[model samples]
Target: MVFYIIGAIILVGVIAYVAVNHIPKKLHWILSIILLATAGYLLFLINNSIMEPLRFNTEKQIRYTEVIKKLKVIRDAQVAHKTVTGDYTKSGEDLIKFIDTAEFAITQTRNVLVKQKRGLITVDIEKRVVDTIGHEPVRAMFAGKDYKNMLKIASNNNIKFIFSVDEIQKFGNLTEPVFEVKVDKKIVLTGLTDYLIRQELEAATGDEVRGEFISVGSLNEVSENGNWPPYYDKADKNLNKK
Candidate 1:
């Protein structure tokens, strides 16, 4: 639309400049002024149309990066929970409590060779042995973490992220556990301009995005996958692959 308007303005400017040469001096001045005003309005429209998407995408990148960070934290916490409980939990409160108060056994193992003496000969055999070395608290595992802020969206503190876990029956009637953490795009993109939000939704819908929620893990399967593009990983080398 902006391009079309600018093209029309230029065409009109050319025609007006040519026609004004045959008009009286006062009429020429009026027509030139009108053309300049139209050109100024077209410039404003051009700038607006060009800048709006750039601004939207910039803010989207910033907000999505923070959202991915939070999702990674959630993924780590869920993985730890599963490590201790054999399955993930659906409650953020329970997850936070587990993070704060759980303990996991740390085992020490060593490979040893057993030697047996029989009269004047010795036979050596290799074996593995395991021992309970110690236990470490989950909080210690995640020391220096800000537990209070883990479940909230960064842009809008009021909106807590959504987390869920489920058990699904896989092949041969075997069951497996899966977990998912999610936040609404609107929640993460809060404080952005309304125009940007609408554009985001429209683009998402056009692309057939599954939900308004950006998420990691699968509720329908036993996969710990995230809903991010390949380019996202390419862009952020330090991003956790949990």
Candidate 2:
């Protein structure tokens, strides 16, 4: 693109000089060739400038969809792990093992009225109790999902998501289970244009991924949400696959 720009400037100066001076008939063909070549270069540049972004955006959605699909799986797996153990795991292998072997305790909760007396004042109080009714395999919850490769990234087969688990303080110093699984945007968008990747890395818009990493969960908060926009959630959330 830069080469075309430089050649275009030189061609414009030559055309300007030719317009102001007398030219011989022998030079007509040379001028015509230069003009046509310059026009072609300019057209190529214009078309490329227009198409690069379109191609980048197209590939972006495709690769992002693929990676986000796996990310959603990891997120759901982590949620199930937390549900069974009351905490998240940092090890991807442990997460997968838990998904394959864990059991979900089916429980039922109900409210009952109890009589309480406080200093000769008897009143009815509501009490809530929970009971373990049954048990179900955790694997049953992830039916129709991708097995084994749940931790693998779709765009790049060799690359896996960076997984971590920790606790975050909630209201009034209460800590809750938190886990984060992420991969760099550059890795996900590999072999693409560099400048566009830089622009994506600096993305701060709410509709975009909003950071350098396409991640799920947060170490700073207790959210199971991915950093992607709701457009992905519409598909991944409704797909019925963990």
Highest TM-score: which candidate?
2
TM-score of each: 0.73, 0.85
Candidate 2, backbone clash total:
0
Give candidate 2 misplaced runs (Cα > 4 Å). 15-23, 110-128, 171-173, 237-242
lDDT per residue as tens, model 1, 3-35: 677686877768686766677776776777767
Q: Model 2 over residues 66-181: C-alpha lDDT tens digits? A: 88888888888888988889998888888888988999999999999999999989999999999999999998988888857887765588666898888777779888878899
TM-score, predicted candidate 2 vs. hidden true structure: 0.85
Best by lDDT: 2
